[model samples]
Target: MPLATEMFEGHAINRSAAERRAATLTARRSVKKLHQAAWLVNAIRCIDLTTLAGDDTAARVRRLCAKALNPLAPHIKEGLGLGDMRLTTGAVCVYPTMVRHAAEALEGSGVPVASVATGFPAGLMPLDLRLAEIRYAVTEGADEIDIVITREHVLTGNWQALHDEISAMREACGKAHMKAILATGDLQTLRNVYAASMVAMQAGADFIKTSTGKEGVNATLPVSLVMIRALRDYGAATGYRIGFKPAGGMKAAKEALAWQILMKEELGREWLNPDLFRFGASSMLGDIERQLEHHVTGRYAASSRHAIA
Candidate 1:
């Protein structure tokens, strides 16, 4: 799995077929009542609980960590009949500067600190600077590093450069898990997305993500389908399971359920866990919380009622 072009040379993504399958995913696997509630709860546990912004602060990160520790209030958990089932977001994602604050706040909460590195959102910085950023975040106590890929490599067909860069990043990460952000919205074609996904997995990414949330089109079903198919193919051939994360524009409970259904149908039940899947979302948790409130009380609450932080 050392950046071989042959692995994806003949690989072609049928856009229409992928679209059809993505369309049927939600329609065929619609859940309701208790099932919907359970899926939402699972979504909460698989969320990265992210907050990556220009204005992110230590105080904001600490609050986000607190929320990750106790995603649902005691009364809300009791109302949902959760009993002793512990619920917590998979991790708390932040910018490199906020990694230590988040790690310190989440110290013994069983929640890992995820830092968006390699010049996240745009990733236009030099390679050395990007790798150094990853190392800096890891040194600051981040257990996971979400690194953005060089889109120019994909756009210019420089697959080897992309592979080498990602492989280097994986090495820089040391023991910290590495998530390769493809920024599918900027890749321009399903074929490019498919190729990028394959290259990232081959380069040793623990997770292949869809977007950085800055692109015009972020995390669409068509794009996710292409990426997940590549993940399935990689797992089948290598016997190594790579995680998938659909970041950006996912802000509703139903959307979360849709992605879950896609994972269940494409990768089976095993991929539906936090170890293999994650939602790189911020406002999404608020909507899921609102839906959970409705599930327990039978009445929809306003968005303001379920604060994300």
Candidate 2:
């Protein structure tokens, strides 16, 4: 698809209405009992279980891959009356250096390997080096590349620069899908988030991510709502549906439900799948498993029994 340069030519966001709608969403809908359980299961499917750390090793990546493949043990699946359902996370995310380790470990598991690249957590590197990092991750068998945009471009009102930079990163990804992380917390305003989201999709980002999980303020309801609306408008204009990922600070199962509700309410039921929506989460899975266990046994399971790593 060609870039939708015209779509974001004069984009603007209504911050107050966005925040009010975000607040109203939670108050309007409540999923409980079997509905909540089912949503939690869906959350499991849409989780890009992540392990990005300094001490990450081959052993740790392998263990994380194992957990991704069998997020819900057979007993847990049976307990939920989903004996026929073989649930797994959407993908396993690791650093660029660990992409190969994750790829080899997750072989035959049907989970794509996602790698954080372009000097992730702080995209302050030169454009050439950042693009090279994306290609290297793709070569290492990463099925998805999560690249952080140059926040300076958005900060300085340089939409063209941001679009060109992300376009280059998307091209570097080649066959692998590219996810543009907006790091909304650092963008200063909801308008910046909206503009950044539009520029990323216009530049061919397969998904627009909320944060890098390292920022002081990661994903939040209001930020996510603004981005999702941008996605909706972009989809309407270009007819190319983009995906959304809300990362950071979303740990509990209830938080997962809140995001799911937001997606279902804002974008409709079609956005509930792993292809369209994903939670860039690590510890969130542990809490989801605990909740699932409680749903089955009518009691909470020990945290040890549902360890993610």
Candidate 3:
């Protein structure tokens, strides 16, 4: 796991082939009725229900935590016959400063508080500053730290620099899990995405994230396919399973189903669980709730009824 450039240096990702495979994922695998409801429920468990706005407040974070705690309404939970299932989102993600509020709100509920550190959505900050940010978030009770990588490292083919930076951040994280955000949209090419993913895993990232959700293009299936393949390859070589998270620009139950399908087909059904996969979403849960309501009552509910906050 020590900067294995031989694993991906000359990797060639056929763009057209990736697109074609991504296009066929949803069409080829279809889940409907009860099966669809089941998959959506599983997706709810794997969601990093998030709030990362510039104006985020403790009150808003508390409300989001409330949602993460009880994702389904009483009526819907009853209709689905979950029977004290205690369903909750995988984690609640917020900015580093808000970690304490979210941690307090979700305490004793078996839900983790994930904080975005190291200058989220952009890793242009100084290295020491970034590591300090990770430590600060950990001190604030963040169970997971989502750190962004320097896109310039990937762009300029500085694999050692990238590995060393991520390795330092990982050490700063200590016991807290670290998710390395590739910001794949900024990486320019699928091959870069693959190589960045490999290096992040080699450097001790517990997870490799697709985007920060700020880029013009975030979490496209083709880009995700390349990343998944990289993780799959890394697992094959190291026997260490790394998690995958697709963040940003996803807001539909259908999209959730599609990504789950991709994980199932590529990495087996084990990846469908929260420990292995997560959807970094805020709005996607509302749509998933609405779809579940429709599945229960055979009638679509108004979008406002499923507001996350």
Candidate 1 lDDT over residue span 85-198, tens digit each: 888999999999999999899888789999999988889999999999999999999999999999999999999999999999999999999999999999988999999999
lDDT of 1 at 237: 87
Candidates arranged by TM-score, highest first: 3, 1, 2
- The C-alpha local distance difference test score for the whole of candidate 1 amounts to 0.91
For TM-score, candidate 1 versus 3, the one ahead is 3
How does each model score on TM-score? 0.98, 0.97, 0.99
What does the lDDT read for residue 287 in candidate 3? 90
lDDT of 1 at 47: 97
**Superposition error at 12 for model 3 (Å):** 0.9
Residue-by-residue lDDT tens digits, candidate 2, 150-181:
99999998888888899999999999999999
Worst 10 residues of 2 by lDDT: 1-10
Worst 10 residues of 3 by lDDT: 300-309
Off by over 4 Å in 3: none
Where model 2 places Cα greater than 4 Å from the true spot, the runs are: 1-6
Most accurate candidate by lDDT: 3
**lDDT (0 to 1) per candidate:** 0.91, 0.91, 0.94
